[model samples]
Target: MEESEELQSILSYLPLLMRSSSLFWPSQAVETLRELGGGRVDSGYLLFQAISHLRNALSLSSEPLSPSTALGYALFFDEVMSGEESRKWFREVVPVLGNLLLRLPSLLETHYQNPHNSMRTATALRLLDSQLPGIIFLSQELIAALLGCSFFCLFPVKDRYVNHLPVINFDELFASLYEDYNQKQENKIWCIIHYFQRISSNMPKGIVSFERKVLHLKNDYTHISCPDANFWSTSTVPLCRVEVHNSGLIEDQSSDAVEVDFANKYLGGGALGRGCVQEEIRFMVSPELIAGMLFLPAMADNEAIEIVGVERFSSYTGYASSFRFSGDYVDEREVDDLGRRKTRIVAIDALCSPGMRQYRTNFLLREINKAFCGFLYQCKYQLYQKKLQDNGCSSALFDAATSTSMETSEGKFSDHKTTNSQNDYHSMDQGNNIGVATGNWGCGAFGGDPEVKTIIQWLAASQALRPFISYYTFGLEALQSLDEVAHWILSQRWTVGDLWNMLVEYSTSRSKGETNVGFLHWLLPSIYGHDEVIQTQLHCVSCSETDKRVVGMEAYLCGLLAHQHRYGLVDYSNYWMLCVALRPFISYYTFGLEALQSLDEVAHWILSQRWTVGDLWNMLVEYSTSRSKGETNVGFLHWLLPSIYGHGTGMDFSNLA
Candidate 1:
């Protein structure tokens, strides 16, 4: 055969040979095509023929061929095409290639549906790395598609080593690919790598360089640093080559150096000086000096720092200068008519031992009480204004009634209504019989308007309503008062339950012999009703007969309330609190299928409440752990043990069933 004729014949049959299913002699066909293309006998024509053959193969089946064969074909075409030709071909063919790449996973799912096929897929990906490195280049969608194929192929496989084939050596491939693109493409590279890093466990190298470049581009100097020992350490000293002027008009170098040093020192000092004086001063002294100043030996036997004053239930014991409960304190004068003399006040104080005092007094309760009264006064004022707008009642009759009422309540009302004109205006507005009233003056005044009323009513009906209501209206208000007494105990910072625990501890330890459990002990009965109290008592009768159940119940309620206050919703914390609170009942009820049913109810509640799935899973794990202990809730063990802990004996039919 003539060489040209033979070359033509080989080229003519290349497409058909590439697409053939018969594996026998396929490499021979590939070699023939490569040799013809290598000879430069109609080079472009040969390259076109190879691409056409590959395109035909890609078009032939939706199913993926053995990736090795597919990759071999791709490499053959890539080898034939010159860099310029590759660029031209890529620009023209990439959209099509991208579409094909996207469909590759689905095709693999159908055709390459075996363990050996995964290796083929990996090989194909390597070919993609060689030929169409720019195809997956920085395209997250394309990379994700590629990863999807690998993940699905490997997911069913048990061996971890084999499964990692697709991702192995990815960093080297990425670095090489990124170097091909211009700086304009850096962001795309970053986004792609960032996502890949998040999902894949193996950390990609050169990532810090990419990150630094990105930060540099963004001008975010906060994280900027020179190559440091920790990150990019080097053994050799870096050298700089500078071109010096031969015309030596010597520069005044020493003065410039001194000026620079002076500026740096002053700026550094200014920055340092801006920090807390006390902290800076403390750092300046040695422990020996501090001990000596405080009249204690540096290495004395009692070296522990002591905080005096209120030793509250906090992790730290500290001194407080002033303490008062959170509340609106009515003056002894105003409530005197109600026959209430001196208002009871609780003070919370935190004090440090040996020195310094910070007073946190709840004198604000009186201020707050006045504020609530002011709110009521405002409500009354609005009502009076509304009445004045209406012309229904006789002005004289209104005036007479107002005068009589004012005269009769003169002494009590004098302080509250300071001005005569203000009193007259109040009486005149009260005289007008307009039924028109602001919602604030109605039955749901402090609840805001009708919307707030509606919300409150809805909450009142909810199972979780009690905690919600108490926290907002009274419980949280009380917490605020308590916080005022001790500035650190802010509402929502620590729950009423935490305060109660602190109070209980304080009551037990008070040297003055005054033991008041405070409102903490009353919280449970106030919220859950007397029936819950009775049930709790019955459950805890054996543990302690004298109010121990009540105390436990209160603690539990407080914990739940605190959780709600902090998180802005009832969550797993509340469920855990409830579990702790009802533990005695849980123990009593754990003997039979009914207990499992209750456990199911709790699980269902967790699901129904739309709690976080992770939190629910954790709760189930905790429940399983508790049940595994052979404690009270053995029946709970049956359900929790099987579902999450994976320890229960069964046919293991969940997967199949």
Candidate 2:
């Protein structure tokens, strides 16, 4: 009687099951439902209908499933899941089971703990065994082996790995599948990396902190100076501020070569005699005579050689690329609280980029202290940095890593790997957010992973007191995704702790060359519902690329992107998707690379002005590649040479005659 009623119940809704596909459901499910609709299998549709009703149950009920319905769900689920559809639609299937399983305690009562006679107890093994591995990249064969062997053991593991179907090697499988999905997924993930809000634009305005009435003035975090009638100057003598230049005395050159006549020219030669009594004073004593004696009979903590400052004879305005002359003004106000307009300039010995080691974190921090020690007492810069890093302000920044300024390489591609050791990654002002204007921080000029470095910088800035990051993304679609990814992670409510662990896992998997289980996987979980990800074939950044063989007006601009996989620029897949999608074979390279080569010569020919290594990164991705999307060859070069990182330094783009 029960079986007859169940069969009648399944028949009522089996006709309503049409073709449906989702990330959680297999494409084969539509056909499977079609097969069941043909009246060939009545029992199979019965199992299918029971599972389908679970979705209806959840959509309708906020409460748990009834005791009887939950038990029936487990038995029917077991019957249908013995088929391939269970594995294919595993993501959709598992959630229903978990929800129904919630009612087990109510149904079994006390026997729920160890119900040997209960069907729910009998079905408990299936509940545990039926769960599909949540990870998407595992080959179908590995998955089958995993399912067969249970969670803890790998005995059923055949020596072969598999894709949606089957494969021989684990490493080789991901090597092909990974990059294909990464770039294809990025196509759908269009990040708004750069937003240059103009004075006249309708974009959002930032909170400007300028002159306003405030409570008290505090220098850094220490040394608060407040006005009170109680505090008064005790000393009658006027005081002079001493300027410390850690670089050593500016005018005190080494005493090596000097004739007796020149030496005694003005009471010790190079000394100036203004004839005034104050200007005629000469100094020929050790530092100890003027300041405190050295500590530990070695170096003094506050010991600094007094350095002089001269008035700047010129003036300039604007920061970075906006710098220009805005007229000069005379400075008559000389309060000189620290010194008489003096600057203790510590001049370290000049050193070129010595094999790139000079820019490493450990090395750079070593150099920062040359000036830090001089201002340690009065300046709270270092102290401020410590406060920023430790105060747990990372949650405040959601879009920190959203800025990136790089593109795919034009030559042979090699997978980049990194280990997440946040300790090794240090910034002196880790949390200061103090005007850190940077581009290509760990790539381009140095050998490093652009993605990893960009992530690290974002993580550092997230904890900063005032992070004013400027990512010059150069209008590249790929670069913009960094920020978009950051935005999505935040929108999904992933915390810093979540991202840090995800990165560590991703880095570990990256080093092992795992498929479908890294940064993008963590950032965008929605893409992995279907094992087979849909991807568009590669197109030139110059979508309207001209044919090189059939010579025409712009035939010279054609250059082939080197060693493209099926997805062109992405370093995956052996098979290109379609002919129209794949770019036509040209004899040259990527638009960025070719344009860079041409711009180099043009920049020198037009004017002798040199380009800085970071010059191309202007206002976060608005640099050299801004016009690279459509223009080809000489036209690209012409636009680029001027605008790069072209349009050029001051060349006008207007065709105004």
Candidate 3:
């Protein structure tokens, strides 16, 4: 047959073999073809025909093929060939493989991108990474030959380019691998460290870089000499000298001239009395100066300064010079006698600037006063509440009796008698103890229908008593109320600290305790003017604790009392009064809206607070400007301006600002 006819004939049977479910037939047929082609005079021709058949079969097969099938076929060809014959077979097979690969991009675009295909992209990449290594190694020459073909011949440019790619540098590949490995290792180490710290009280110190020595010295400062010094002795020698001249003019000279040779008098290399000039003679300084010079030597050459008796002084020339004292001695006070004597010590007082002392004292006094006032305020609130409870029982009883009788009474005559008797006695009692009756006496009426009233009061007192509830039934109910408020606040970019502070202030300032009642009345004209204690109760309901509901509630109450005094309503509170009050607000707000606001308000608030297109654009600008550091306070401004303009007012940014 002609070459074209031969190729066509081979291709016809290829599809049938490739699609056959019986792998045994295809393997045996491939083996028979390989053996027959090996002896043919036109071996290349027969091999090429066989390879073309396989390629055609691969292309035409309608049945879905597993990766194992492709692997099996490749392995079969590899096992049947050797040397030149193997090269020839690989060369013929690669073009078909290249053609197959060329179809991948299109296949990916269609099969992978199509939502219906649902191909696992990661699995595909992993498979490629795994299979490419073997293909590149086994058919290196054939793949290289195919790469040299025209881009449009049988395969696309991308396929040919990838197939014939050379081995990447081992160093670069290893570097990448090492980096990835190191990062994973570090992550594991960090995870171990965190686990140990979290799960155990005692943790190994190996993970931490702690100094074991007392000083934890990074460098040997005590022994190292100055870099300028020739040796340890040279660095340690004092630079100052006192000399008494023949003219009786005492003058100071640089001690740099006092070399190690001159300082080491014990060497005895020169005779002490030889060529001595008595007229120009002068006594050397004290031995203490010489003793101060001895120290351990530094090992490093650059560590010369470390050996110096004192830290090297700053100078333009890089060498430190010592200060000197020079003066002519009086006739009675002999210069030799002064030189022989020990250096007199001078005692001096530590001097401080007037402004510094004043500022220090002022800060100290302020802190002390603040602490004292805080203590006094706490005591006063406690005493006040105790006294109110003790004295207000009579009025509370009167109110409770009146309320109960009104609800249960049958007729006007009975009601009149009850009212007249109670009122006549109340009027007379009120005349005498009006202050006590009006203040503390009212709390006894707090308990109405213990269940219903408690629930309502609890609902109303959410901010105050929420932290104290042992049962979560009310909290679950409250959560529905808190959702809108929390979403509104958290959706904004306020820092936790700023948000926390604001909630604290609002809760504290609006409490309804007796002391805060006066301020609540004052602020009533401005806003809702709700009772401070009730407002505090509402804020407390927002706390996020799981079991300490009662603690949270009492904290809220104490915070309310503290805040009232802090704002001058109670006369002795500290600056942190508002901060304390707002603590519950932050906690509860985080718990979600069920603890705070009604569903309607929450939904409306959340919808209204949604970021608008303009706001997003502004945020982009703000983010960009912040990255470039073009503006100092853009973040704060973004938060504050919108807040002041009522952007998040319904959610309450007043205290935060």
Best by lDDT: 2
Better of 1 and 2 by TM-score: 2
Q: Model 1, stretches more than 4 Å misplaced?
A: 1-375, 378-481, 484-516, 520-573, 579-639, 643-657
Q: Give one digit per residue, the lDDT tens place, for model 3 in 1-657.
A: 122321232222212221221111244334433443343312333433443343343442332222233232333234323456446434444334333333333332232233212211111111111111100001112212222121111111222123322111111111222333333222222221222222122211110000000111133323111121111112111111111111211112121110111111111111111111110011111111111111111111111010001111111111012112122221121111112111111000011122223123232222212111111111112222344366675354323323222213222122221122212211211111000000010011221111221121211111111111111222223222232333333333222223323323332443423223222222211122224434533332121212222222222212211111212222111222232223331211212323222323332333355432223234344556675876544343334234433566423333211
Worst 10 residues of 3 by lDDT: 433-442
Please identify which of the two predictions, 2 or 3, would achieve the higher TM-score against the true structure.
2
Error of 3 at 409 (Å): 59
Q: By the lDDT metric, which is better: model 1 or model 3?
A: 1
- lDDT for each candidate structure: 0.24, 0.25, 0.22
Worst 10 residues of 1 by lDDT: 206-215
Summing lDDT over every window of 10 consecutive residues in candidate 2, give the lowest-scoring window.
188-197
lDDT of 1 by residue, 559-652 (tens): 1111111223222222333432233222222234343444544444433544432333344555667778865364543554454445545223
Off by over 4 Å in 3: 1-169, 175-541, 544-548, 551-657
Q: What's the residue-level lDDT of 216 in candidate 1?
A: 16
Root mean square deviation (Cα) for candidate 1: 37.6
TM-score of each: 0.15, 0.21, 0.12
